[model samples]
Every structure is written in structure tokens, then in C-alpha cells.
Target: MQLTIWSALILYFCVFLAGLVDSAAGGGGLISLPAYLFTGLNTHTAIGCNKFSAACGTGFSAMRFFKNGALDWKIAFISAICSFISSFIGIKIAFKINPEVLKTVLIIILPVVAAALLLKKNFGVENRVEEISKAKAFRFAAYTGLAVGFYDGLMGPGTGTIAIIVFSACMKYDLKTASGNAKILNLASNYASLIVAVLNGSVIYRIAIPAAICGIMGNYLGAGLALKKGAAFIRPIMVIVICLLFAKLFYDLFARYFLGG
Candidate 1:
């Protein structure tokens, strides 16, 4: 498809916003994917191009996390490896399973998740990693990567948000650290999905390349903010991302089952 001037602007602007939110919280695809579809791309092409730009943006954030000492290298590496491998398998399973089923489940679960976040005022406020054993943290990280990565491959939204929550709740890292580590796992999964998109010849480089630049800028700024503000900043953004994902999934289910669109 030809990249019209208007389309390019729309893609860049939305992708920049997506990168910012995604870097801080993890549901950037909720914004970017709609923007691509709004620009008249088919679903497959939109997803492919989104992956390309997201991978690029996520890489920068992941590096920033690493440099700033926010990440647990061992946990990040273990999760990345597990997610990278399982994501491939998830992709294969996608062809066989209907993603709508998963969406239905998420719609129900998101509210409880959101309520927990809202009611628990001190949820991710402090870094509690000292309390957890090294072995237990690593185990949780691996399980998070495998389970969430598989979901990412199969359904493809809210991966980072879920990862951050799991890291904080289970591993007891603060929100900032969780967000940083989640970026590493996200980067791995993004690359895995991008490879499949590339192999299918679905990525539109003309659009993805320029959009990726915006993504990088957004990610750089967003990561900086998260680092500076710590959990106070990341927590609200995560809640917003979860709410948006919930709305998106609810709408899809509504459109499919009720509206018949």
C-alpha cells in the first residue's frame, strides 16, 4: 500500500504516543494498532507494521533500563530467553485456537485486576526484592515469561502490562524495576513476532521506518520519566493501560458477538 502524506503523519503521531505509554506502562499497541487500521491498512499488515515499529521502540527503552541499573540482569535474561522461545510456540498455536476466547477471559479478569490495583494503595510503591530469594525471583520471572509470552504470541496485546504486574506482585520488585525488566522481556517477544511478520512479507518498511523514529523518541522520553518518578509514575500509567486494554477487548467482543461486525 502506498503511504500517503496524511497516513504517515497519523501513523507517526499515534506511534509516538504509543511508544511513550508503552515504555512507561505496556499497552501501546492498544493505541498504535487502531491508528494503523484507521489509516486503511488490513489487519495483518497493520499488525506486521506495528511489530516492526514496536520492536525498534522497545529496544531503546530496554537499553535505558539496563544502563540505569533498574534491571535485574539475571532475571531479565532468563525471562527473555523463556519468552523468546515460548512466543514462537504461541504463534504456532494461534493458527489453531480462536483468540476471541482469550479476549473473553481477559475482559472478565481485567476489572478484578484493576480493582486490586486501585484498592491496594501501596501495591507497587516500594522495592521489596530484598525479601525474595534469588532462586524464587528467577523462577517467577521464568514462569512470567513463559506464560505471558505465550499469551502475547497468541493474542498480542497487554503483554507488558501483565508482565509488570506479575513481576511486582510475585517477585516483589518495585513498579519502576518491574517496568524496566518487563521491557527486556517485551523486546524479546517483539523481535520474535517481528520476525514472523517479516517472513510473511507483511511489514511496510516505508511506513515502519519513519514511525520507528518517533517510537524511539517517545520511548526515550518515557523511560526517562519512569526512572525519575519511580513507582509513583509507573503505577497510574499501568492502570490506564489495563483499563484501555479492557475497553478494547470488551469492544471487540461486543462487536463480534452482539453487533455482528
Candidate 2:
């Protein structure tokens, strides 16, 4: 789709900010996706275009994390493979069902995720990264990436926050390791979904390029901050972002399902 002068500028800025927020918390799509829809692109095309720029943002973040010594390559490798394959399945699931139902589910689940973070007063206090029996960690990482990756491929929100939380709190990974792994898995999902979008011919390159540049800049700053500040910073932001995103989703659902607008 062709972009107007105003829309192109806004799209670029939106992507850049999305990348920043996404790096900081995880729901960058909360901004970019709706802006795309508001600009008159269909939801499917907006989501596809989102993946295009998100891929670059995520790749940049992952590399930055790696350079800063925040990543664990062994787990990232397994997660990338599993998340990529599962993301394809998520794309298939999207076609098989109406996402309206999923939107409803988000209203409930979003609050729970938010509460989980808000309730925890001091998150990531100590580094308690366990030496997982290689097989078990791989198994858990596989499930986490596979499930979250598929959700990302299908719906396109909250993937990064979920990844960080699961890895750090649930899997007992250090904040650094979790962020590193999250960046890689997020990128993998982007690859899978971008292919899906391309196959379906939904990409809007005019917006994608500008948005991606913005996203890269935003994420670069965010990743650096994450490395320096730790998960405590990310946790609160994730809570607020999910709350806002859910509110928007609910409003969209109301408009679409009831108001017929």
C-alpha cells in the first residue's frame, strides 16, 4: 500500500517508539499495530508489515544483548528453532479461527499478566540461574518459545514480555540471560511471520522501512538500558503496556462486534 506524506512520517516515528517500548517492556505492537490499522491498512496487512520492521528491531536487540554478554547461545539456538516452527503453526491457527474470541480472552489474561508483575515488589533481586540438566532446560525453553512464538505469529503482541518473564521468573534464568534469549526468539518469530505475510502478500514496504529504522533506534537505547538497569525496570513497564493494550483491544472489540464501526 502506498503511504501519504503524513502517514509515512507518523509510521516511521511509531515504529521507532514501538521498538523502544518493545525493547523496554515487550508490547511494542501495542503502538504500531493500531496505528497501522488507523492509517487504513487492513489488520492482516498491518500485522504483516509489523513483522517486517520488528524483525530488524529484534535482530538488533539480540546482537546488542550478545555483545553486552547478556545471552546464552545454547538456549537461544534451541529456542530459535522451536519458536520458528511453532510460529508457522500459529499462522495456520490464525486462518482456522476468528480472532475475536482471542481478543475476548486477552481482557482476562492481560490483567493477570499485569498483576503478576505489579504484585512482585522486587523482581530480579539475585542471580539464581540454575544449571539445568541440558535436556530439561531445552525442553522448557522449547515449550516456552514454541507456545509464545505461535501466539506472536498469529496475533502479534506481548511476545517479548512473556518471553522475559517465563525465562527469568519461571525458568530461573538471570535477567540478562532471559533478555538475550527473548531477543533471539522474538526475531525468530518475526522471520516466520514475515514469511507468512509475504506468502499472503500483506507487507507494506513504504511503512515497513521507516518504522523499522525508528524501531532500531528505540530498541538500541532500550537494550542498553536493560543491560544496565535490569528486569526491575522492564517489569513495571510491561505491566502498564499490557494494561493499555488490553484496554485498546477491548475498545476495538466493542467497536467491531457491537458498534459495527
Candidate 3:
């Protein structure tokens, strides 16, 4: 589909916002997926195009985190490998499933996660010592990769948030480190999904190219802010993203099941 000037401009703005939020906290797909759908693409095509822009943004953020030495290469690498494989499988399954079913599941799940974060005041605020051995951390990281990566590929939203939540809560990493490491694994998941999208001819490059450029800029800026401000800056945005995800999922459910829009 060809993009008019107004559509292209709107997409740029939306993707930029997504990149910023995704880089700082996660759930950037909440913005980008809806924006793509508004362009009249079907769910699969919209998801494919979204992965293109989101992956670009995530790549930029991961680079910044790597440069700062905030990422644990050992964990990130293992997680990334697991994420790639799980994401590929998830995308394959997504091709056969109705997205409404996924939205229904998220509606039930996201609020609980948001509530948990809200109730735990000290969560991800500071770096915590590893509560388990290296072998255990590696095992936990692998599990996180498979679970969150599969979710990312199938639903294309809130995967990064899940990663951060697991990394900090289960792996005992600090928020900064968790966020940074999440970017790396998130990139892997996005790339894995993107490959499937490309093979299935779901992406529209005309829209994706400009949106990706805008997304890259936003990621760069957001990652910079997170690095400078630490968890204090990231935590609030994470909360906001979670709330937004919940709201978006609720709307999708209501529209499809009731309003039928």
C-alpha cells in the first residue's frame, strides 16, 4: 500500500513515540501496532511491519547498552539464542491462530503483572545480588528467553516488560542492567519474527523504511535518557507502559467481542 504524505507523517510520529517508550521501559508495540492497523493493514501485515520498525529501534538501544557495559554478555547471548528459536516457533503458530484469542489472554494477564509491579515498591529500583549460582542464573535466563520471546513473536507487545520483570525479580539484576539486557534479547526476538514476516511476504517496505528511521532516532534519545537517569527514570515509564498495554488490550477485547468494531 502506498502511503500519502499525511499517513507517512503520522506513522513517523507514532513510531518515534514507540521507540522512545520501548527503549526506556518497553511495550513500544502498544503504539506501533495500532498505528499500523490504522493504515488499513490486516493483523498479520501490521504485525510484520511493526516488527520491522521495532527491531530497528531495539538494535539501536542494544548498541547503547552494550557500549555502556550494562549488559551481561554471557546471559544476553544465551538468552538471545533461546529467544531466536522460540520466537521463530511462535511466529509459525501465530500464522494459524486468531489474534483475538491472544488479545483475550493478554487482557487477563497484563493487569496482574501491572498490579504486581505496583505492589512491589522496591522492585527493579536497585541492582540486587544474584540469589543463585551462575548455573542457576543461566538456566533462569534461558527460560526467560523462551517464554518472553515466544510471547513477543506471537503477540508483538510487552515482551520487553516481561523480560525486565523476570531479569530483575528472578535473576536479581538491577533495573538498568535488566533493561539493557532486555534490549539485546528483544532484538533477537524481533529479528526472528521479522524473518518470518519477510518470508511470508507480510511487510510493506514503503511504510517501514521511514518509520524505522524515526524509530531509530527515538531509541537513541530514550536510551540516553535511561542511562543518565537510571532506574528512577525507567520505572515510572515501565508502569505507564504496562497500564497502556492493559488499556489497549481491554479496548481490543471490548471492540471485538461486544462493539464488533
Off by over 4 Å in 2: 256-261
Q: What are the per-residue Cα lDDT tens digits for candidate 2 across 1-261?
A: 677888877877888888888886678888888778878899789888888888889889888988988877878878888899999898888878888787898888878877866787656555566755777888888888888888887776788877877888767776666878888888898899899788989987877777888889988988888888877677777777888878877886787668767
Q: Distance from true position, residue 240, model 3, in Å?
A: 1.3
TM of each candidate vs. truth: 0.97, 0.90, 0.92
Candidate 1 structure quality by residue, lDDT tens digits, 129-217: 98988888888889999988898899889999999999999998888899988999999998999999999999989888988999999
Residue clash pairs of candidate 3: none
Residues 136-221, candidate 3: write the lDDT tens digits: 98998899999888888777678898798889888888888899989989999999989988998989898888889999999999
In model 1, the number of clashes is 0
Colliding pairs, model 1:
none
After superposing candidate 1 on the true structure, give the runs of residues whose Cα lies further than 4 Å from its correct spot: none
Error of 3 at 224 (Å): 0.6
Higher TM-score: candidate 1 or 3?
1
Could you tell me the TM-score of candidate 3? 0.92
